[model samples]
Target chain A: MNAPLPAAVDWPLAVHQALSRLGFGVIGYVPDAGHKRLIELCHGDARLRTVVLSTEEEGIGLATGAWLGGAKTALLMQSSGVGNIVNALGVVRECRIPLLLVVTMRGEYGEFNPWQVPMGQATPEVLRAMGVLVQRADTADEVAVQVDAAARIAFGGYAAAAVLISQRVIGIKSFQEQAAQ
Target chain B: MSALRRREVVRALLVNRGDLLVVAGLGSTAWDCAATGDHPLTFPMWGGMGCAAVTGLGLALAQPARRVLVVTGDGEMLMGLGSLATIGVQRPANLSVVVIDNERYGETGMQKTHTAHGVDLAAMARAAGFASAVLVREASAIESLRQAVHHGAGPHFAQVKVVAEKEAITLPPREGTLLKNRFREALLGASASLQ
Candidate 1:
């Protein structure tokens, strides 16, 4: 287990540093508000390639491909994206592909929208059922630290692991909140 | 011209393969690739339904020096049509995706796929901005496809119409881990044994 980086006290910055330190070759993600800052940070650094995916499930295949080509990879998505990843994870699991997923929660803890609830609630259980190790992070510092630890476990042993950034830490989304951007 | 043979098209593409990395989609395409000859560099998807193209895309992006090819059926290709859009946006010059369009789901009792009803996958790929998108209905044109796939500067796409007939089920090694590790070892050498 790795300790939280000095930058871990913050948020998206902390998560970004964790991925950077691990030397991830590729980062696959769909458009996500919770992951917007992190995704932007990972883009075009020369150290890694951040791919814009059509769907979350595509990220699973992308990660698998990267690994097979001797490159390390990770996926960033909202919990809703986890549902799209259900069948795709079977490839990663059965193939023993080293994978790390960083997911941001949307349905719990001050969720303004009800629709995100069903899939968000099922995210962890769904991943666990698919033979993925799940670790949830409730605080800003915990999120990146867990991502780093999970990545180590995954890449070290050719396993799949995910760090779910809890909704509380990711901040609540509302129409008014959208007013700023 | 009538439909071409699936195994022949796959065999033609893989003849002097050299260093081309292949990702075969589930069902018949996998069997077709296996029917030719099993190799460590060729990953036949026993499970992932529509991921072969994107999987090849990932490899293409990672190893920009190596050409990656994806062989998938029309049904599997249709299932992940969104991947074409994604590939279009990325446009890795080293990737080529070929759909063995039998117009039917050969593995599942020959149910007609979208291609059977006049769906043009090559046109879709062209719209998706592939450098080369051709619907190969003739064996004579396969030489050009092989040239484009192996040597052209492109994210290429070709939907080769094939006869919807069953071939011998040439099953490759089904163990995913072994397939993965062997591919890694072949591609990455000692580094594969490490992580």
Candidate 2:
């Protein structure tokens, strides 16, 4: 007898739900295709305040302010945006402010954009160098667990933590796919 | 209208401040805030240049009942111009951003900034959708600015034009950890370290 295929997991929805469960009242983000569902979910939720950022660095400031005001907050961004936020991360790390970053990875596993590779490969190390605890989720099933753990460590411990969602889970966009579109 | 004195302007703004959390940008603005009086609620950044306004936004969002003010310089405000738009959309009523437009980068030896080239920060803030955005060129207009900072329904933005001149530096506590802890203690009291 043939076994049934496992159910397809919706990682974005799962992550969004996890953030809500974790008591994040504010979500600051720069738009990315990988985060479409999560962004939509946040926008529709009346309890959550969604902020669209022009640069990733602004999200850091927004999250910092939100925390200071006694609200739990999260920042959502793509890996490429990580480069823009290194300096701002100092405020979070040095001040011992709790922060949750959900980053969608690019330039790995059949990536078409060469520009994204350097930052994508360097993201974890960069965050680590800045004193952020880094966690990874390669499969859809791991999304909720990793995000939940990161949220706990960040808010409960008053420290910075990041959950990097791999490109494989987000479905890598190849050059051919872009050309076809 | 002649440019107002920054030190006096800052002092005036904070004269009646009560339970207000302040996030000061680096250099001159930080010094101005320190000169007024150091309080546990004051968080003065030593190096984070463009993060002050957003930092105030976070503090305001975290404590909706308390007012959060961000006092920053022109160069710093230009560096973080995008923050206005973010604040515009979020519209945190308790948050206010006051940009001290000396029109120069005072820390870097008085180099001219974009504001000197006629950049209108208040207009930018207005365009970005702040509930109230004003330019305070005259000292006579300060009372309205004060009202906006303290009791106005906002995300308010104000660009206070001041003469580009050096003043005695009044540095606040330098240790980031100490500042953070004190702020947390002042806000959360005994439960600050509970987490």
Candidate 3:
């Protein structure tokens, strides 16, 4: 078998660069193990401000307002949060506000929660139906490069861009990993 | 204002000589406020509720010199009413929120909204910390928007009553995500100025 990936590569830096390329001065997120390092980087950076949201919908709203005020912004959440953001899609579809959303996928590849499966399977279809652009990252290296491209598509085209992180990239966070073994 | 009248008003505003920032929705009023050509940024939809004003607030906070406006629908606004308080606390002078109060979720269907009949939206804005708020129910909305943007200090709110109508306007999708790139560059430029 191949060797496990080293932790020294620094996923947070990659995510930070990706956010910068996406024109995000501020980002809204709901904390999760998949995004812990990324979230810390955003909070620590002076150029980037992190808005911790109570709900996924609030992050969407905050990103929208940031776009209007002349600052580029993005939302970081999990696949579960995508369920909470569906109704708000009408605002972006009608307004054409080009938002960049980076979501950590939960249901694919040894998912623990049954509730997250539907949204995970439907993510691409749902995004396409709403006219959003979606991309998936299976590795941290890909997350950095692909996210930059996604951000360009979002801002350059005035379209919403979504980056979905696969389970492999996130690894396991809790007892779920032990149970999987 | 009728739906058609609202469209005329928005169209007029866009055609006028000045930079414009608008928050649209999948509703009649949103189609009415549709913007064309190269805009700074457009944070399109993904079913997240109550994000229009919050996003608008972010942009306004970043770009103090630019005249930022959020053209949100009544239903969408109600999703994040708490943002009004957030806006109040931040006090972005360049920002103005123009709520197209048709009193219904026009895009999903003609479902009633909380503001379907004179729901004192302006009063709510005032309570949320806006220095000025107004309600208008006529075709003369362009002037009101302009006035609100010009006089907007702290946070400003305006409710424009419109008749319920839903229609789609076809436009080519924007390409390559220049909107986000430009926004970052703009923010960097703003940051440079602060130094």
lDDT of each: 0.89, 0.86, 0.67
**Residue A115 in candidate 2, Cα distance off native in Å:** 1.8
Name the better of 1 and 3 by TM-score: 1
Best by TM-score: 1
Q: Arrange candidates by TM-score, highest first: which order?
A: 1, 2, 3
Candidate 3 at A116: error in angstroms? 2.0
Candidates in order, TM-scores: namely 0.96, 0.94, 0.62
Q: Which ten residues in a row have the lowest lDDT in candidate 1 chain A?
A: A1-10
Misplaced by over 4 Å in model 1 are A1-8
Per model, how much of the real contact set is kept? 0.67, 0.75, 0.57
Residue range A25-59, candidate 1, lDDT tens digits: 99999877778788888884678888888898898
- Rounded to one decimal, what is candidate 2's iRMSD? 1.5
**Cα TM-score of candidate 2:** 0.94
**Tens-digit lDDT track for model 3 on B1-195?**
344345655565555536545555434444454444334443333345567677677667666676777777788788778777767666677877878777888767678988876577888888877877778776655576666665546477887777676556533233313443454445445552222
- Identify the runs in model 2 with alpha carbons over 4 angstroms from their true place: A1-7, A175-181
Candidate with the larger lDDT of 1 and 2:
1
Candidate 1 interface RMSD to the true structure: 0.7
Candidate 3 C-alpha RMSD relative to the actual structure: 7.4
